[model samples]
Target chain A: MNESDLPSFLLDGEEIPFTPGQTVIQAALTAGHYIPHLCYHPEFVPHGSCKVCTVKANGRPAAACTLPAQAGLAVESDTDELNDLRRTLVQMLFAEGNHFCPSCEKSGNCMLQALGYDLGVMTAGFRHFFPDRPVDASHPDILLDFNRCIFCKLCVRASEEVDGKGVFSLTGRGIMRHLIVSAESGRLADTDIALTDKALEVCPVGVILRKHVGFAVPIGRRRYDERPISAQALDDAPRMMEPKHG
Target chain B: MAEGRIRVATASLAGCFGCHMSLLDIDERLFELLEKIEFDRTPLTDIKHCGPCDIGIIEGGCCNAENVEVLREFRRNCKILVALGACAVTGGLPAQRNHLDLGACLSEVYLTEPGLVNGQIPNDPELPLPLDQVHPLHEVVKVDYFVPGCPPSADAIWKILADLVAGRTPRLGHGQIQYD
Candidate 1:
């Protein structure tokens, strides 16, 4: 097929050119358009778990991370209805977890919090669930504060696919579902996980943090502090290919 | 009900009073605010109870029975209620205790801690009994507006107050809305 004959899709009225098999989010990101996402990382297979990137493709709601960008498809993402849905998802994440952002080391750099700000999620809509989850400080170099996990699976994919070390996996189902270590002892320290592992850098929330580096970057000088998530998503999208740790 | 001025009442229940401090951060602009809004029931005025008012600003989560009662009273007395910080909006730091057993929490604080010379969980009827879990303001009553921050910035509070005083619905924009 000719270059001009290549398939394209309309995302919020902008023409997004897509090669065959490219998801809506992939095409949008390449085009400098950001569809808010948590689970979908470019380096790994698209995981549609976190549906914060849900958009209306042909007036039907679909997760942009997994949805294929079809020719002439009208995708509505920035609409009030879609934004409200995203806000509800973000709110659910907040309510389900003990996300004490003010105390979290990843406060300013957290993608979940940044997305919440991007979507204008002012309140945790539902009543706080306050699940009793344990923090794993067993690892000498890493601190796994399970209270802040949003179940995005970015770390799971990064560990499995990129780091070549299956250190993490999601266990259980529904509200009881949570991240579990792959080691027999069920501890991150038991696994061959290192400080330079891609898993450590892929966590969108404050769940997987490096020890001895809490609040190293001050509040005002943090990544998402200076600019909103929307701008950073586009500008920093390509930088995902660069090795984060090492 | 004052004819010319907007009546504002403020309270801090299970919070650190940081939001009130942030409100005070308006500094010289507070004098400008005083010209438009009058204090009704607030810590600033040392008022005991919230009177009938145009706006009520709550700065803490409902962690105790007294907090709930004060929140309910505010809802009954005020025309519009605003959750003025992370605590009021999302239960904040006080809500961190929601995951642990209430009894265990009390024991940890009173019985187990080494610092206490005479460690005992108080059973006095005079003390306000804490709820099983900390609850955000909306969990107890309808919150018309939410100013989200650890303790929303002085400018954010000022904007909300100024907008309300000017007969505008409170809306945070750009730098005004921050989670931390």
Candidate 2:
């Protein structure tokens, strides 16, 4: 089929041209439209664990990051219903973990925090779970604050797929599922994980942080500090890049 | 109506009064604000108890019995109560102690810290007892509105107040609303 005959989908009333295998998120991003997402990094395979990118496709709720964009598909994102659902999902993430944003080093730069702001999640709507998670500062250069993990698994994917070092993995299921270091000693230092690894930069929250560099960028000048996540998403989207063919 | 101005009361509970500072950050706008509203039971007025007021803006979480009492009193006296910052809205920095044992926390602060000469956890009857967990103001009393920030920006506070003074519900949008 010719490139002109490629499938195009309507995302919130805008025509987004997509390759046969491109997901709604990929097409939307490529088309300069921003869909709020956490676990759908472009470099890694879409892991729809966080459900922040849920959109209504043909009147059915679907994960935009994982859903294939088909011709004539009507994907509704940024609606009141989808935003409310996204807010609830953000609230659930907040309640599930001890996401103390004010004290966190990753406060302004965190995608989760920025997304929460974007979705108008003003409060933790659910009761605080206040889970007793451990902070693994065992690594000499990295501080693994488990209390803020959203379980997006970007670090896991980046470590295993990109870095060629299977350093991180998620253990357990459902509410109990958590990120675990793949080392006999169960510490990041024991693993081949380095500060320069893609895994360190892949975390969307304050979970995997480099030690001694807390609050390096200051408050008002950090990423997402100047603009909302929606704007940031569009600005950060790859420019003029052709859609990847399967 | 006989009342010419909106009666406003504000208080700080377990907060650092940064929200009040942010309110002050309204700057020269306060002169304009005074034309529309009047301070009642606020730290600005040094009033101990709030009289019946048009709005009550509380700026911290309920970390002690006094905070709860003040929050409840604010609910009773004010027509509308607003949670004015992250603390009042979500327990903020004070709530960090929620993860640690309260006794251990107090002990660490008092007895176990380095360079402490004579350290004893104060148990004065006059002192308000800290709750086992720090709670957002809404957990204790109904909050009519919320202005969320570490301390909400001066623009945000001004917007909320200006909206309230104009008899409209305040809504924060992109630039106005910030979580950090």
Point to the candidate with the largest TM-score: 1
lDDT tens readout by residue for model 1, B1-180: 557998999999999999999999999998899888899999989989988999999998999999999999999999999999999998999998998899999999999998888899999998899999999999999999998999899999999999888989877776678888
Q: Score the docking of each candidate (DockQ).
A: 0.78, 0.62
Model 2 regions lying over 4 Å from their true place: A1-3, A240-242, B114-118
lDDT of 1 at A93: 92
TM-score of each: 0.95, 0.94
Model 1 chain B scores worst on lDDT over the 10 consecutive residues at B169-178
- Candidate 2 deviation (Cα RMSD): 2.0
State the displacement of the C-alpha of residue B143, model 2, in Å, after optimal TM-score superposition.
1.4
Model 2 lDDT per residue over A1-246, tens place: 444667798988988887777888988997789999988887777888788899999999999999988999999998998888889988888878888778889988999888877877778766677778888988899999999998899999999888999899999999889989999999877998888999999899999999988977898788888898888888766655455532
TM-score (chain B only), all candidates = 0.96, 0.96
Report the CA-based lDDT of candidate 1 relative to the real structure.
0.88
Per-residue lDDT tens digits for candidate 2, residues B30-49, read 99999888999999989999
